[model samples]
Target: MKILSIVGFGGQGKTTLAKAVYGHLKPRFECQAFVPVGQNPDIKKVFGDILIALDEQTYTRPKLLGLDENQLMGKLNEFVKEKRCLIVIDDIWDKKTWKLVRCALQESNCGSRLVITTRIYEVAAYADEAYKIQPLSHDNSEKLLYARIDDGEGKYFDSLSAETCERILKKCGGVPLAIKGAFLAEELPEEVGLLTQLVCLRAGHWDYSWIDELPEEVGLLTQLVCLRADDYAIRVPAGFIGKLTSLQELRISCRGKDAIIMQFVEELGLLKELRVLKITRICRSESIESALLESLGHLHNIQELQIGNYSLSKYRVSEAGSLSYCRHLRLLHLDRLVFSALPAWINSSLAPNLSYLDVQVVVVKDQDMETLAKLPELSCLILHLTGTKLVSVKLLAEGVGYFRKLRFLKILGSLIRFDVRGSECNSSRVPSNNTIMPGLESLEFGVHVRSLKDEKLQLGFDKMLGFQNLGTSSLQRVKAEVNCGGASTWDVEEAEAALEHAAAVHPKHPTLLTNRVESQYMISRYQEV
Candidate 1:
């Protein structure tokens, strides 16, 4: 007369531990219920909500709206088959809806107790006693982060700083809904400048907690149009971002000091109606990258610009066209800024509505992939290639048909060498009648095996001709990582048997995620050949 299943994953609380064991055994049940069954469940409204929670004055709501699902599971198995029931159910997602709600629960030996909550481990292995729910111990996650920042009144958790409560419990890693949304309150209550018509404020915790300063009454939030304080050890005082000149979205992460991030990059040229600018941990200096390229040449209504860490290789192509007045630039993320080329204002007449491009480069030519495949609304490309000398870039299967709206291609590097020129091969290694990125769907790459007794740094995966010229039929997913640091073990079994024989001869047979790693061991491999 006990079912019990709790399982985890998904904020790890499992419906708050099955509502604390159904409120400590629902006063020794005589018919109790608590139902949720989400992820699209409406099994006749869950058997008419368990027959109106087992007898609401004889199943109310017009007696179960003219009963359906097998007459509301035959009046919920004849009223829990003679009483003493305590059902739960809550969030069970599939096992054919838990065998259609376990055929209306009939096994009542009068001490009946069901209780279920899941994230799916084969529906908690059909519960007889499954319970998996772990996560909350580092002394119960610092007593639930000081009882949620003092209601247990330890005076704001005794004024923080045990390195900000171990960086807010190592960034709320034990996840009680991320420590109840990490409200690291140590400051910012100068009566928050009476919320002067706050248009949106969003503080801290995007990745970690840090709010050491920002209260110059948050520049009296002059109708802030969206100011996300994405914590890089916060601290913004001096002219708090030019009084948020009606900011149209500015995510921050300035690491501080360097004259307060060069006076927050000269007050970001008074945010001329900035259309989403994200600045992260910046300050690699050269006078804060020439005052952030002179405040990105006055953000001409910049549309989604992200500039992180620094290093635009001594900018010159007329100072890297200071984002050539971002003509409504659509999403550009330049994180580990490394360009040595590929800048010249990222063409198509200065970013004609560029659609998502992340960059980092030391080399990538063939006119930097034909100036990023002539940009007509380029769709998602993340290319990194920091170079220390092993270059080879070819990729010209009709220049991937000028990526007419490319679909998400990532390529990080450890001394590049892509090569996919006019594919035509076949000695039985299949793949390649040449097509590449034809509406590509998700392809990530990163290799670097370094020294498998260098026959020009032996790359395998059947000599990756840029993944056998990806004859895309909208490829669905292919990730590779490799890096067998100082190789061997037959070069990691010849790079995992040439990535499981190139995902068993790909042609949109996608889903191939390999990892490889080495310097002792690491292997991950997911195939779907």
Candidate 2:
């Protein structure tokens, strides 16, 4: 993988440029991983955020890698061997953070790339490709600023006297972020003051590096960001993500990730809009977490809370505060964790909406499941179990039918059932043996043990049937899957033909099925084959 850095002074749009590159490059890596690196970590929350971003909702640190950075990198190395990935390092502050992450990044393929943004030019020099962020010209700067507020190039541009426009652009310094910062800071009343004035002050003063209090429209640009509806549900704007009242879903990994968070959160004021927060590693004393959560008492609507790179040591474990206030929460992915025991500060009622929860190193006491499953939204759950003790998946599945919503479950590195036993599975009334799920549109289950190629093929078919037999409301089975990759159409077609034949054999399964292997995609299927 090649390291590339986008470097320039603050407000130069390094992040914006990096994001554009990431948007263009992410598809190249099937197992792509992206994180904004930050300082510090707690033992318990290390892997949750990475897992979440990888779409591995059930990710938990393996027992072998508990708090050992090398061991962790070793696992990432294995993933690199299996598939290509892209790791984005955003707003990197120092060299040590680079060192710690660089080891894991080394696992990608030759063409895999690293894209980083930093204020320091030295950091850019370390990268294979460096891009410097530059400011807009005097004319383009005015064009860009005015482009933001008014609808278009009509009277808004014509009415703007050249002299006034120049002065406004000068105040904004022709930097994109600052222009965005000011334009986004637009609240009608506050904008009234700026537009009517002969000389407008930049909303965030570059001289003092401070954001001035503005009217509501301009104010929304601070903590309350304007985000699309879908984004608010899954990924919110960088500014809005920090301001959520209850961090039901948050994973902030970098050092300043938290401070950047508080700045926006104070601005947003927990106004019922936020839902998920993905945090990086946060390092306040053990007493801070509970206190921090307390401030979030007003957010009762959050459904999923993710703490990126959650460590065991940095926060207080109390039964009080925001953690307990989330009455609607269903999922929690706590990464980089290292707590010996689960704290009592959490309660089932707090996560009444919780369906999926991934945490680091918890011994899944019977008590934990008992409280966890009772949640109204409880359904799918994954526990990495970062320990040696074995626990039966069936035994775990047996209790949660009241959470009939609870169906999908995963226990990573657990000795309970290395292989799913028919007897054990059939024994559960919850359809554990059925190997199928009802009301599920898509089913993606993976088993990583070494299996013969033939066995792997057979198992794949068997698993598909298992899914259909469980009887979804309207049975949904593997259908029309386009496997895109490789260097030739013939190779892709050959593979697709084989898959289509397999689907054809399953007459009892869902009918509609087609397979098209695509070349010019990211990675070829045969790489692993």
Candidate 3:
């Protein structure tokens, strides 16, 4: 029996140890059980709750056997079978509860490990081994502090202003919670106020929870309004992120001015552990130098990659060799791009793993459309494009229906033109009857249409007006828009009618459709309201 117990005081890392141990050992065990006994306990009730964590499917009826101490021992003995199992009783206080349960589970085999964490040393001694987990090392503590700091708008604190770092470290005393709360306080004067409050607190009396600190910073959420920035060069000092090898999600929003922040954009490649990386607006030209998609290949575990406004500029599809690197990506959000249709290199339909894709690009070609259309696992798509050059909607008419799990779709602009003999929308390019998007909830599109030389119908809008797919889609919201070619169509009569039509089709909901020229229609989506 490889039994280990972790013991520590009230705020020490007891729960973290159990979680880490389980994370380490679960794949090895045929069956694993994790039980958390809090500071106060009803031993009987905690044990009864054990069934929920165990991965047992056969037992449909979960019976809570309220056995006496002796009967409980028998029940535990009966509970564990030949399979190598794990039983963790956390925060145990008394010897009576331990002796009975310990004796009962003792019949299990050598590979079976038992882990328990409690503050009381006697309870810890009952186990075969123990570990004392202390607070953060100076470096580990500071890394967390610097990562979340919003250095004053103009100034970047790489080393956190020499004196400030020292003062914070001295007062916080290596206690992680205090360190976080202290640095997060408003001004130097407020820090002094917090310190005064701290000195008044009796030993072991301060509430360590961050939730307790919410009221002080709650107003910041509403007061914050961001002005556009080309890029931001925030200081990500070594101590803040040096040891973050397992780091997955990274969101560095640049609410700064119109300047290049290569330090922020380029350093991403170095963090081998990065998965979900989100950065605000960067000029399209910034990416030509960026080995972005390539650097992210190291993060094979990435789920989401988000970029803000004007990020995806005109790169040929061939330049998008980076998309190939993200093998496991599920969600891609391109917040606000200047144009439509993603660059050509991104035209790989082979990303079978993608699920949710949202882009604000305005330029997309037929091939890019076809490649994205074929993604089988793609469930939701929100593309707010400004321009599209596809000659025929058949590419969509053909491909979108094949997606079995597709639920939400929003496309903004498209061009219409196709030849009859496989030259325009090739004979083989048509979607089969079953290929229509069936599970759609929200669809918004605009296409350029040449009803004649004198008029251009936003073809995507026209298709949505007539196209109806039943049994295949359970659409809850549909916003179809058409470009009337110019400003003459932007009248009150047109807006109200379109809005009224939207209200009637989705009558239960508010207005869903709009008709306008390209500029107003595309820009409207980006407006927050």
Candidate 4:
């Protein structure tokens, strides 16, 4: 047994270092498990997680889920009896839980290795060798502080003096986590009200199991241009973020549904200067849903927005037209939401400035394609269509220089066909004054296939190649994802070979890749572009 322990102070990076070592050694072992035991660890859940992580192939998922703690330990013991395993148990706060876990791995004499990370010295004494984590040096601290001091427009750090940098480092005391939390607060005077001028702020890593709410003082930073409170649960006070009149970028993840959070979303429209906003963990709420649809119409200056509902169940985009006034909007990503067809606002008159759009839908229509083609500035587009049958859709049809600036396009879903045989889309014709996606550089197709002799897939590849040649031929990469729906895997192999050969003949000789989902065949070819 190769046993190692990582011991450190509360904020001295014990778990971080343990994860690094686990990632490096995982591939060398026959089976691997990494489990986090928080301050108040749940022993039963921890053992269950270990069994699943170790790849217990002898039992079905349903059977494993139903196993008791003793049965789970038996399954884990059986799995590692004949195979070498690597295990990491992170952030153990007490000895009782460790003893419980030790009972499961005690007699598996298969040359297994274990790594434990803890804040207590007693836990470290249980291992063969203990590694101590240290604080960062002054030079390293300076580099980290300087890299994170950027204002929204990059003016804040450029004006920071050497004396100010030294003062901030001394206050951090060489601890990494402390350095992150205590940034800029010491050098800037409170009487001068520097927080009002601050733009970007990233809170320290939070463990939500203990911490539940944010400081009310956060609402006073009225001039904040960007804010990121990732993976932290916060109870929002009414009009908290709306006070930041100049705020342009905000990224936050909420834990559950609350009326306070809904009010915050409703008031977001008051900050007309916002250009980028991303919000996650949207649960079911009628008030929250109404506020979202009603408030988005007021963001006239919005540019990039990403909204994700929990899943495809109850979420609906009923008022997509609310974004019609977002003339500067680009790079929109909506996940696990349902829309009947393309929204009407995706037209030249409404959202001409759009450069990238990613959305999921159940069906698409011809007018949707026409409207999308008219987006003169569109460069990248991803549509993940899911439904009964995502059969046919026309792309870049005959037009007056539609998709002229398109550079990348990805379409993923069940089996679909591309009809490019129309005379208007004749790829053999000489490059006329008008062209489709002339700047196109990469194309990806993901389709569900019944067999390798999938004629629709083969024909789609042929047409896609022709589509690539019609462009600048500055094409640098092509990828195809084939999801198998039948027993035979030979067809996917042949398809991959054909794609590789096609890529070989291109003038630029771009990189080509074919990934077979049901089987384990992946072909990647890289050539000089």
Candidate 5:
């Protein structure tokens, strides 16, 4: 089979180019199918679409849904084996999906053709001839933008000034999709309300100065399975969320008082189906009432919870600190909370299903580490240790094992940054028989070079290399970010070289990313795919 692939970023016209090619080639082939395989695709639906495109007589109903992927592919292969088919798979996201789809498109030895369109480079590399979609030229982009807005002839275009047209074209960013969406004539009605039987609804904080609150009509959408609202200026209408009994996910980021906010948090107990919930920027002076805390415990179906920056200074931190009630919680993130130590309820009985835990704590107690090691299902841990002095503890110290299933570790904030020049800690701190996190596949750590004036900061490359000697030979990738005040080229190259040497002996050829940036945290660095 002959294959042609088009690859580029979103809005770069990969789909448009595929459509154009399909239009030109469909007439020449005996059978053709153009299928859109989005980010999350069902292979059965894709096979059905291919069958319909080829005008094949096949039963596509609820009964067919029970067929496994292999069964579906087998039926599809039989239909297109002999025909000179032209198949286009659009917007493929990953190789695993492509491999599954490719197995069904067997080589007929009858001059069939395949075309793939994707944003990922590795997927495009599978093609015999791959073309990278380039950004539109200045002249072509202007022509396209004018064509979308112009009234039939050039009369409307002649009325506009050169300066205004130039300003509009500049915002298009050399992308045809952006240029096409630039100008529109109609404006929405002032008094607007969404009315639907939708299973999901997302409302933005539209013009906080003008729109203070959501329309009362939002209460009508009781069938909502997921709701996302980011409104801070006004309180959500009382008893609003209590109606969405079917809601599986709820995400809200806004500001309100203790009574108003806790009242809503209390209402969450009514959502028996809730699996994921996130509440951010909730300001409350009084501690959460025991009754309200008990309300959160009723959400036994909850698997994911995120509580960020909830200032509860007056409340006893330990009263609501333990999450033993959330037996099914799989992912939890607690950010900027004042808790002296790890809560007592973090055992396997409290959150046995826990897979990911992200916490930003004031201090990292030794016993806290010991407690974390006991979680059987835990696979990823992200810790943001706050105190400057207490942050420099060695993670690879002997006998610190509890992370049997842990695959990824991300240490952020002050804990990652170290004042190497002034610290009394020496290289001896690196455990000679260090044996922690033996199963880790990825590690992202940062260093504070914020005060490295005159480049006096010795980029700790050798010390990093010493980490490779730790008991965990499974560590395959390491990402190190240096806050190099204003990173010079010299600093970046030196740090990268050190990481390369450290992983040189690794059997898996571990990857090392050294991000040298001026900010407090390292900015993300780009790598060739």
Candidate 6:
């Protein structure tokens, strides 16, 4: 038998950590119970709850209602003395409560375990072993913030600017609860307006739950430099954003009526000092589209811009000639928005400082590729093909030199065929050594398999020798999502084998991850190798 206690201040994740440990070890015990004893817990009620949790089938609420604290203790001692059990008593406030609870659980030779969580150090020291929990570190704080804000998808978090992330983390001060509450809270307290000197504020729910209203008091924070609210249902009063003229970075989303969203877009034109702007969940309309384009033209100082409607549908903004006005742009992410082709203004002369680009287009023409390759500082590129027909694109040895500084490249499309120049030989043989993306560290692409006999679509384990042609020395991670919708059992096996073989042959031996997608329209579940 053993007792372990965890001590920590409020909001340091003591309960969260205890719950995780309990979940992992509960299956090994004969019986398990988790009971929370708050500041003024009723002794009889706490004991009764534990008895019910340990034997739900036998301990009915009606049957236990008649028992007093002494009777409940008698039942608990008799039950636990014979059975090996795991119990967690969370949020104990005082030593008196602990003594009563401890007396009820009889010591046994059945190899039982007891865990407790408390904010009181002396109470925790009463256990056989005490663990003092500490606040999260800087790296873990960032991970937790991103994980909560993105809801595990990680698409939005990756595109965030370093300056914005740092400001939010500093505000959270390494507390796990503060980090999570900063983004997940449903509504701010009315007193939030009192913090008139606050320079940064980030608040919203990840699940897109409808908030009744954003406190109009938020407009009082005129000194805020960074403000982010991701809730889609927030209806900003007409002049709410205009009040925060000092804001350098702003992110907001709305999925409500069209009139509300149109007004929100028009308000952006007032922020002359804005450096980063991200707006999503927009309901596209002719009037709103015109207003959105006009607003983009006004933000001359903007350095990063992200706009999209997410999964609602592919938003069409091909006529956005106003994008040419923001010459200082270094990062551009157009999520799920489909254009006929690359925007005419996306060239070296217009966006000379461009480094990171993510876009979805119907077809990537030769001229479009040429324009993208000319980006002097380009480092990360994510391209998604949305055409109905198969689009064949080639990466020639000579053209590979253009992406000398590129480090991360991801191409996503089931109907696109990527043919590397020197990798056209037989599946079993290695390709001629032709290094591509010499500085690349991460590579991700999609593969579509319709049949085993079709040579054009055969990217099975044997046909994946194209990886050898990449910058193997700098490569660190490779991910492939194979769609096996119509392929037979043998074809799936061959594809998996090919991925494993490719990973093994690499001289640097980068970590390999394969996502075997069973259908084209379904979500992918990844399997790491």
Quote each prediction's TM-score. 0.30, 0.40, 0.47, 0.56, 0.52, 0.55
The model with the greatest TM-score is 4
Sort every candidate by lDDT, greatest first: 6, 1, 4, 5, 3, 2
Per-prediction tally of clashes: 0, 58, 29, 1, 0, 1
Show the lowest summed lDDT stretch of 10 residues, model 2.
Answer: 227-236
Write one digit per residue (lDDT tens) for candidate 3, span 327-366: 5777787554343346443333445577888765645655
RMSD of 6: 20.8
Model 6: lDDT of residue 87: 95
Who is ahead in TM-score, 2 or 5? 5
* Highest-scoring model, lDDT: 6
lDDT-better candidate, 1 vs 3: 1
lDDT of 3: 0.51
The number of clashing residue pairs in model 6 is 1
Please list the C-alpha lDDT of all candidates, in the order they appear: 0.70, 0.48, 0.51, 0.67, 0.65, 0.74
Q: Write the per-residue lDDT of candidate 1 for residues 65-160, one digit (tens) a residue.
A: 876788777777777778888889888888988887777785566878888898899988987889888888878888876665563436555554
Ranking of predictions according to TM-score: 4, 6, 5, 3, 2, 1
Give the per-residue lDDT of model 6 (tens digit) for 234-254: 556555776888889988776
lDDT of 4 by residue, 263-292 (tens): 787888888888888877754575676677
RMSD each, Å: 21.7, 22.3, 15.3, 21.4, 13.0, 20.8
- Scored against the true structure, residue 49 in model 3 reaches a CA lDDT of 53
The 10-residue segment with the lowest total lDDT in model 3: 196-205
On TM-score, who's better, 2 or 6? Answer: 6
At residue 184, give the lDDT of candidate 6: 30
